[model samples]
Target: MTPTATGIAPTTNSTPTTHAGPAIEITGRLGERYDEILTPDAVAFLTELHHRFSGRRHDRLADRMRRRFEIGNGRDPRFRDDTAAVRANPDWKVAGAGPGLEDRRVEITGPTDPKMTINALNSGARVWLADQEDATSPTWKNVVEGQLSLFDAIRGQLSFTSPEGKEYRVTAERTPTIVMRPRGWHLVEKHIRFIDRTGRGMAASGSLVDFGLYFFHNAQQLIANGSGPYFYIAKLESSEEAKLWDDIFTFSEEYLGIAHGTIRATVLIETLPAAFEMEEILYELRDHCAGLNAGRWDYIFSIIKNYRGRGARFVLPDRSDVTMTVPFMRAYTELLVKTCHKRGAFAIGGMSAFIPNRRDPEVTQRAFEKVAADKKREAGDGFDGTWVAHPDLIPVAQAEFDAVLGENPNQVSRQRDDVEVTPAQLLDVHIGLPITAAGVHGNVSVAIRYIEAWLRGLGAVALDNLMEDAATAEISRSQVWQWIHQDRETEDGTPITVAYIEELIAQVLGEVDRRDGDRFDDAAEVFREVALREEFPTFLTIVAYSRFLVDTE
Candidate 1:
């Protein structure tokens, strides 16, 4: 029998409290306690709590996380925003997705390391993503320290004290935009303050949100600073979840002198349910949603978590020898882009893996070719970008994205505008524009993006989304790379060419136009769905699928 805290009865069972006590440990599902912080019942109860806990309990604990760690207890009576134009930016709502939504870019993610991020940046895709939550050490201390280092790197730190001095590529920083994946709740406030100070509060121009409430508090803090901050919200499962955030934003700005629409937001589409309600969520939050970014790993984990009752049917069996390109991974990427573009926000793709694959030089060349082909496919579908892990593979990553952007189109490149866009103006695009029928992938941007990815090799790495690879994978992918010249035919037999790529996109767009009308109908929406169809890579997916999207059967 176990020892009793009160010495009452060895056999007497004690109920667990929301807040752990010495008598009742706070353990995770495995029943292993950290300093006797948990018990079996505690673990079981916590797991159930994630799905069924009442609002009263949620409010109490969430408030604790905020008050104790400065994570965010909900309303910030002082927070205010002046930049409402970001909400009404015309660029946020691109009419006629062309194919899928991520039609213009791909992501090449690396670890949180500076070297890894720079490498991926050299590749060519539009965004450089960094992470601190899943791929990096999850402890509070390491995460806070690691994220601060990235912030320093981004601000172009100067060492007036030390002659040794350190500097990054170009005068300031390369790549059009920067994205970071900071630690979630556990170290949220610490991480935000670090980035803010490191960047000299330049984070004022940046948007920072973590994976959960932990992530939101940082953004709240930033907004509370008499400024505006943007965010990419992750792990969300429903439109109701979207509404909570909307309400959170609403209340956060109430009383504060800030503009209601200043806080731009994008959703990290990770879970299956989120993936399923993609379009509806997009439509519902069309006023607030910035865009949808793909989340492959978490998406897979979600299917396993939520669909295990279906047995083998839930996830695919592990297949060796070939890359794990599951139908669902591909499907998820496609749907993400479509959802984002349909509503006018950028449809961004996610990272492939944490480790760089392709150890043999020949294998590397072949893999690059395959990845390039896939990028073209995604561009044709409509994804604006995708993610990469290794800097060496940046070129490979960008080569794939080049096809979708097409000569820059001379459009405004900033994330926000100065004046408000009326709902009527937005509705005109939503209801009046014919659904785009363009689909194809090929161009200088594609090759340039790849070149940039390799150059970054992690040195010019991203700060958002914990997509493994980064340092370790770079060497492996490089070891296997053959460095063949561009425009070579791939192992998949797809010839690389801008003209041919454009034709491909045109075909896909034509099909999309046929499915989408001036007005939306449920069945038409289903047909336009990028996920429901498997064999055919929808317009957006063809561009976003990298080697690491993960195969879901």
Candidate 2:
């Protein structure tokens, strides 16, 4: 069969080789074992599997492994029903620039603090990550299910008005743009059947791989019924995992008579392993992806528990401070923007747990201030948007997002015709450059990237251009990126350049001079002023050098 124009090759054998069209095919020796790709043992195992099980049966095993172990391939239940409807809705127009679907509206699941989603919508929030995952409490989780049933029951007469003396009621359809949070890695089955769609059976139970397969099967079941998400897929670790789901989606779409590319998917970069594979996973599922969100809490835990060696401890923290300040995390978020933007995807940041006006009024205010600061900071850092749980905080959150939404980054990607250099990439690789006395001349690379993000409105920021943004309150990100960049390599192994780099620093710092003039003074800063002055700068220096000679090369 002729596959899609890009040659839809199934990453797993369970996927149909006979696609809508054949774009890619593997013609090598057929193997049923993982080791076959390299060692003789692998090959021998595949040989045994080939003889032991039918081709279709063996493909199922590989398919399952790819889903569970791979991390980011799991699906979120909230989106299960609306992808196609939104796509088919007469109002569902495609976005001109963002990745996946263009109508980047927020989905206000009945339980997702409706006030928050509504306000964010008013304030230009792109999409809300409403869920069972990180945002909602357990009580809300149970209530959300009931809400779903209410909305689903009156599918037709959805609008109702509660009169002052009387009351208003109508069909309670879920909000269109909110992304649902799954129960977690442990409860994907429950999420898939009832939460994702209406079902009450063990048919939905399975492991990570099995859940992914169910997504395909379920999507196929609902495609004609006008149900099922395109999804905010989660818990994945490898590009192979992404490819596997892509295969399943492809196979299922064909069976269900849905157009192959209509099903959109997003990955939750919730852990360190998932973080590293961000680019690759996006690349692999470029056709089917909606976008990627940085899962802050999970990612923080993952960094500590799983990716401790990868410059994590410093950016995150040992204490409850849990700041996403590590050079690597900063780079990760910036790259989240860069990777998604490069491919025209939406770069969404993780959630802010700063629920406001709590029992601790002071804590709530600080939390509010922190959220407001974070919004502007992350926006400047390259993100298109971010998330929050409380309605009061949404206004500040929306304000921050809006500040930089259309602000073209004065990023230093410009080059002469036939030019092949970029500031960020240059700073990532080419570390042999001579050093200045402040430190190795090579250390300047760090300052360069940090300055770039700042100059480009991504670094050193404040709200209303005041002490509002965290970047301005701390160190500039482009500086860290520049240092990391010059020390790092381009994806193609080409060395990055330093010319645009220094310009980035000078230009951004120049902006700092123009707006706040380094009066980035803060009695109550995101990080304590004393700590920022004493340890952060020096720590950044060490991180910069680590990039210069680290095994990243």
Candidate 3:
């Protein structure tokens, strides 16, 4: 069922009431157990958060736009001279790893559906990233049900049964630590409206709704279970944003009567601007900070999106060619480890989005080999842990970290003092091989297939043996847009234009299966709107959500 929102409904005896605050109204249908999550106290908590921090969220988003404009006008992002003290000071350190997060060698990331929640927790990894951002379609049902799943999982009641009578349950005696990832600050939840002091109504902040609901419902319970409300902050562009999160964490602890510094967050240094402010970001969130992750896919997309107009030197080649070993990615990851260990925080590596194909042994073996090599590089480079998308890869990633970190929780003590990265090294995108026709076709195919699945309410889809999520989709479409705008030609010197791209899209669509209920046609339209348009869309997900996903009933 596609969840939609209408106007507010009058409160009944069964509904939760907000006695003294800015009013909130639920426009989406209250499914079973939804009321438990959206109780009176929970609504009031969300209302309070909106009243206090929504304006600051708007200001931060505006800052992002202004910075993007400046970058398009040739203003390069550099490390801040004013924040040098935060970088130079060797005495300060983050609050380090929290209780269950001390050893996160193999973390598995996936959506929060009941089945996935069961699989991920029982995957034998140290941490399960119950992702609500990139790996979830934010349909109102998904939004509420994801929280429900996490709520049940935390209480040891989450399980699922397939139509074929197979049962899925978390049988592991010790499940992974749950580290929830809320949506970024850019998105909004249209199903709920927050009416402020002036009677002005606005869509609730997605970040606040996700974090607030989870924290409100599960913070105390998690604390009792020996795990705090840990998080992985996504898509932050500056340290000021980190400071805002820190403030939110502090306020949430106070509001819930939890201890100060009870919440720990690991900021994903994904954006180009964020790469320059690693130390400052860690400093801002030091009191509540766990570490930083090399969000490699989104980091690549950020580079292409921010510098798309700057010509060939900044235009990256095919997505496949931009491996972590490239000079630019190496600079980002090495610098992440250095900055993290320097501040006494855990340094988590990026996701190895490889899914084993059981039908073909050769293919699965190759993927395993590649994943092992990738994890080995990360482990050798001083990353305390890394992420994988499949359960089968847990031992593969853990073995590498185990070889490096035997009898130790992490290698935070092995600080890479010799590592130094420059602004040029971070911005260097000229080292990869040239683009090819095969690359263009691959991007079009993946974007279309992934978008179709996402439109169908599935966020993570395995395509051609790789687990493709929103981050991968963003990089795919953005690369296509960048190539067309820069008038990039394939290695064979065939020009890339809108006409050629349209033809390629048609060909790719033909190759896709026309299933009975598939959304391939709609997905193709979205691709054209985002990739073929003259003006670049900030996010393809936002565009598709506003048009097709948001249904008002």
In order, the Cα lDDT scores of the candidates are 0.38, 0.40, 0.90
Per-residue lDDT tens digits of candidate 1, residues 165-236? 644342324442444554322122211111111112111001122322222223344444332344456556
Model 2 compared with the native: what TM-score?
0.46
TM-score of each: 0.47, 0.46, 0.96
- Specify the poorest-scoring 10-residue window by lDDT in model 3: 10-19
2 or 3, greater by lDDT: 3
Taking the tens digit of each residue's C-alpha lDDT, what string does model 2 give over 22-100? 2212212222321112233322222222222223333544654443343323321111132333223333221112222
**Candidate 1 Cα misplacement greater than 4 A, ranges:** 1-104, 111-125, 150-154, 158-176, 182-228, 249-258, 283-287, 319-331, 354-360, 409-553
> What value of lDDT does candidate 2 attain over all alpha carbons?
0.40
Clashes of each: 117, 63, 0
- The candidate, 1 or 3, that scores higher on lDDT is 3
Every model's Cα RMSD, please?
Answer: 19.3, 19.5, 3.7
What lDDT is obtained when candidate 1 is compared to the true structure? 0.38
Query: Order of all candidates by TM-score, from best down to worst?
Result: 3, 1, 2
